[model samples]
Target: MGFLQQKNSADDSIVARIATLVLRLILVVAIPLIAFAVLYAGFIFLRDGNAPKWVITAVAIIWGVGGVAALFWIFNWIVELFSDTWRARLQPFVFVGPALAILAWYLAIPVGRTFYISLFDRDGPGTGQFIGLANYATVFTDRLMREAFRNNIFLWIIFAVPLTVGFGLLVAVLADRSRFERTAKALIFLPMAISFVGAGVIWNFIYVVRPPDTEQIGLLNAIIVNLGGTPRFWPAHTAIAPWNNLFLVIIVAWLQSGYAMVLFSAAIKGVPVEILEAARVDGASEIEVFFKIMIPTILGTIITVTTTVVIFTLKIFDVVWVMTGGQFGTGVIATQFYRQSFIARNAGLGAAIAIVLLIAVIPVMIYNLRQFREQEAF
Candidate 1:
């Protein structure tokens, strides 16, 4: 035992020395590289070719270099005070610093701003009067705002849940056995590659409108026109807006189905062959085995996927924004937040809407947590 301990200690000592050398070398290379980038940017400015942009670029590079240098210096100082053993332990942050800085700058700051906006009457331009709890109250009371909230809920339940689950299960099951399974999955999953804005633009043709006298270029309208039906404005019609919203939901489903299928397929493959064979031996139908055995066995996965889709639905914005611009009573919470803050120039109301969205995500998150805990227990 003493011999084994001695060997392990020797290995650890060797590893620690290697780590320290690597970290020190990285700091030496990175500091100079960042300095070179800033110097080159300065040279670009001196040449009078987009100098101001180059100056801004140089400033960013300088900030990055300075930050990296300061961190390395502090790390070395701490190591000297503590010991070289501790310096080796601090090496991982040499690679992780940029990611941490980005997260702090972009994600952390925006979240803080949103929270601050929720508390005040922000409107038009500058910081307006602080109105505590007033924005939250307005969210519940205002009729249009209430409708927008209801629409989001409706989308979450009716669209996000069924589409994410059903499409995932369907595609996964269908692709389980087939000569062209890979090709079919590749085709089905292709939509996932398209951006939200791009998807919205593509679907725009599907819901396009044209006058009866003119040629029908819209896909759906052209089909209707050929069927001897009158030309109709799809989004403009109040009776059709909610259904039109479903078209937008279809885009989200198309994008997310690939994600769900990938997860559920893995879960399905992990099912024990013995259990499946036992069910087959008992003369169980494939359908029965799937629903009664397979679905129940993978219930945890189903719940997780549903909750993830629910979060996405709650935070949906771009497709709706590009499609209807929150008109025809089809405005959801996310788009409404943007519209209120930027378009309507009512930052307080926008902040209120954003707060409402934050509250709305809470229940779904709790449900997700419960699912995770249940899975962990098992």
Candidate 2:
């Protein structure tokens, strides 16, 4: 009789646990489905212009925030339903799943679509015919595209990466012990707060050119006129092949240097004071300590900052587009992509250029990831 009673108690406990799990599972499944259905209906009402303004607004806020919270709670509850080992395995997935799903929906799908479009000749939205590598060939072979590619390379290698990193390091070293360090850094970083378009507009005034004999409104030309020199069209003068690109690059450098400065400053501060004092004891000059000790210690940061700036430079379009409109040999890969896709209405070529840009960026991204992993290992 005692053995039978113990067995009956165990069986009842198992049944109750199973029932509890079933209830949780039902809530997890049902709540999201119902909330999403209501959300979809609300959106339909909004699209059809049938709902009152208050109804639409209320539904949007409640469903958007409340629905997301409810879904998160459901996932958390589901994770808790498992045993310790299972929960440990499943918890990470539950948290990371939504973000992975979002990336797939927004990033992966669009990249796939762009790749598909790149394989075909697209007339507006319609894919006209399959052209295997013709678009890519045009990108490589065409003179304008080649120039744009060269210009992007020049910007990345010569101007953007070096100047930004170099000036940032220089400024960081100079300002590190200065009395007005914060103010100087803030003023240098102020340009970064401005939008690229806004920066372009500001620089446009700086670079503005009027015909000779006209009152030189531009800062550069006004100074030149005052100095008794000609007010030349700076951006349009193709006589300076590729040199004109430098003017556009200056705007990007001015904006990005502050970003590099902040990073480099942090890395510089992180260098051990003990090590610096030891170097000084060994009679190392300040410049020698900086070059030999400080730089070697922060080599990873330099590379990281350089690669980051290089990636931005490769996709530089706004400055080129806003200031020069990609004319007069200032064309870059991004502006060319815009011109091909929207301006020239050649979607296939534009997609190819975008793919190329993606390819160029991938190596730098991989290097950066490796640097991160190496840092984690340390």
Candidate number with greatest TM-score: 2
Tens digits of per-residue lDDT for model 2, 251-295: 888999999999999999999999999999999999999999999
Q: Which ten-residue region of model 1 has the weakest summed lDDT?
A: 1-10
TM-score of every prediction relative to native: 0.74, 0.79
Local error of candidate 1 at residue 127 (angstroms):
4.7
Lowest lDDT 10-residue stretch of candidate 2: 3-12
Structural RMSD, model 2: 7.2
How much does candidate 2 score in TM-score? Answer: 0.79
Every candidate's CA RMSD: 7.4, 7.2
Backbone atom clashes (below 3 Å) for every candidate: 1, 0
| C-alpha lDDT (0 to 100) for residue 369 of candidate 2 | 87
Candidate 1 per-residue lDDT, tens place, 255-309, comes to 8999899888888888898999999999999999999999999998998888788
